[model samples]
Target: MIRAYAAHEPGGKLEPFEYEPGSLGDEEVDIKVEYCGICHSDLSMLKNDWGMTQYPFVPGHEVVGVVEAVGSKVKNLQIGQKVGLGWYSRSCMTCEFCMSGNHNLCQDAEGTIVGRYGGFAEKVRAHQGWVIPLPEGVNPVTAGPLFCGGITVFNPIVQFNIKPTDQVGVIGIGGLGHMALGFLRAWGCEITAFSTSPDKEAEAKALGATHFVNSRDPEALKALTNSFDVILSTVNADLDWPTYIKLLRPQGRLHLVGVIPNPLSVPIFPMILGQKSVSASPLGSPTTIAQMLNFAGRHHLEPIVEFFPLEQVNEALERLQSNKARYRIILKMDH
Candidate 1:
């Protein structure tokens, strides 16, 4: 049996719960969860905002734990090995995408918290493939968010082959944007932070931004026209899309890691004339995740986080829902 905190209905408080996990599959590995990060997606699932959340929901995907057990066919990881799991738990290894090292794009991928229990528990199970070993020297206490939020922003850097010399702009310096500022700064790019909150200018620069632009200022934005090589939007809220599009240089890319609720209204003429492009991506693949972890470990790049005990799960959720989290929230499990 796995002991966990779960909500029985939409917008319900998480309470102590237990369930029988049945038999472990041949390729499955059971993780003894140590710490789990609370992501915005978890809150969305808790409220059934996406219309796909299962009841008796356990919402955590940024998992840092140890391998308690592995099935007969598992080979790469051993019991007692420290590891992490992110948004995905399983993907069909036989798919072309998986074979090509892009398993995150597999058509039949399983989310850690989608139809199954996740890391907000004493134990959680995932296929061996999705279990990533922590690179040597990586701090596990604050490493949880790197698996989800960290990777969400890092994947695009790899996908787009963003260069160190590139001029990059990051929009919305909250959970995702803050991390982007850190990574892009370490990647050797000159980063400009775009946020409506002028108060965050000091924090943004402290996180790696070389310049801060109040996104609400029209003059500030217009002055940077055709200046950026890449602009990463990390906020879900819709904004002045056409103006941002114009900020891109010729052949520049405007990439989105945030899930905007509405369709984008982009100016077609400018994009055609400037050869600018718009694109979006999900989390990185297992291989890319490993690379990201290694880079973070080398740079000591960890999310600015607040810690909460697993028993205080509801309070942590409330903090996140109220937009009071400094950057990320992690739930420490009592062993």
Candidate 2:
């Protein structure tokens, strides 16, 4: 039996719950969750924002844990290895996308919290493929966000082949955006952080932004027209789409990693004229995740995190819901 905290209804407080998981699959591994990160997606699911959450939901996908059990066929992991699991729990290994190493694009990919109990528990189970081993020099406590937020931003840098010499812009210096600044800086790009909050300029620079732009200021945005090679937007809020498009250089791209609810109202004429592109992507494949972890380890990059005991999950949720967390929030399990 796995003991966990669960919500019986939307916006309900998480309470103690327990259930016996059936026998593990031949390819599954059971993780003894040590730390789990609370993402905005968790809150959205808690409120049924996307309308797919099930009751008694245990919301945690950014998981850093020890492998407590492994199925017989699991060859790459041992019972005591440290690992992390992200938004995805598994993907159909035989899909064309999966076969081609784009498992995150697999149509049959399984979300950790979509319809199953997640890592906000004593133990969580997932197929071996999604259980990423933590590399040396990476701090597990602050590593949780890398699996989701970090990878979300990093995947685009790889997909678009962002050049080290390119000028990059990151919009919204929050969870995902903050990390993007760091990754883009390490990738050798000249980074500009665009944020409505001018007060965050110093902190954004400290996080690897070479310049800061007040996104709320029209003149400030207009000054950078046709200057950026790539702009990565990490805010979920809709903004002046046409203005951002105009800021891109010819053949440049404006990429989104945030979950913006509304359909984008982009001006096609400017994009067609400049050959610029607008695109978005989910998290990366496991192989890409491994590469990200290694890069993070080498660079000593980690999220700015606040820790809360697992027992005080409600309070932590409130902190995130209130948008008061400095950055990421991690729940430390008292085993």
Give all candidate RMSDs, comma-separated: 0.7, 0.7
Model 1, residue 71: distance off in Å is 0.5
At residue 193, what lDDT does model 2 achieve? 97
Model 2 residue 31 CA deviation in Å: 0.4
Residue 59 accuracy (lDDT) in model 1 = 90
In order, candidate lDDTs are: 0.96, 0.95
Note the residue pairs that clash in candidate 1.
none
> Candidate 2 — which residues are off by over 4 angstroms?
none
**lDDT tens string, model 2, 1-335?**
99999999999999999988899999999999999999999999988999999988999999999999999999999999999999999999998999999999999999999999998999999999999999998999899999999999999999999999999999999989998998999999999999999999999999999999999999999999999999999999999989999999999999998888899999899999999999999999999999999999999999999999999999999999998988999999999
TM-score of 2: 0.99
Model 1 TM: 0.99
Instruction: Put down candidate 1 lDDT per residue, 274-329, tens digits, no spaces.
Output: 99999999998999999999999998899999999999999999999999999999
Supply candidate 2's per-residue lDDT for 190.
98
**lDDT accuracy of residue 305 in candidate 1:** 97
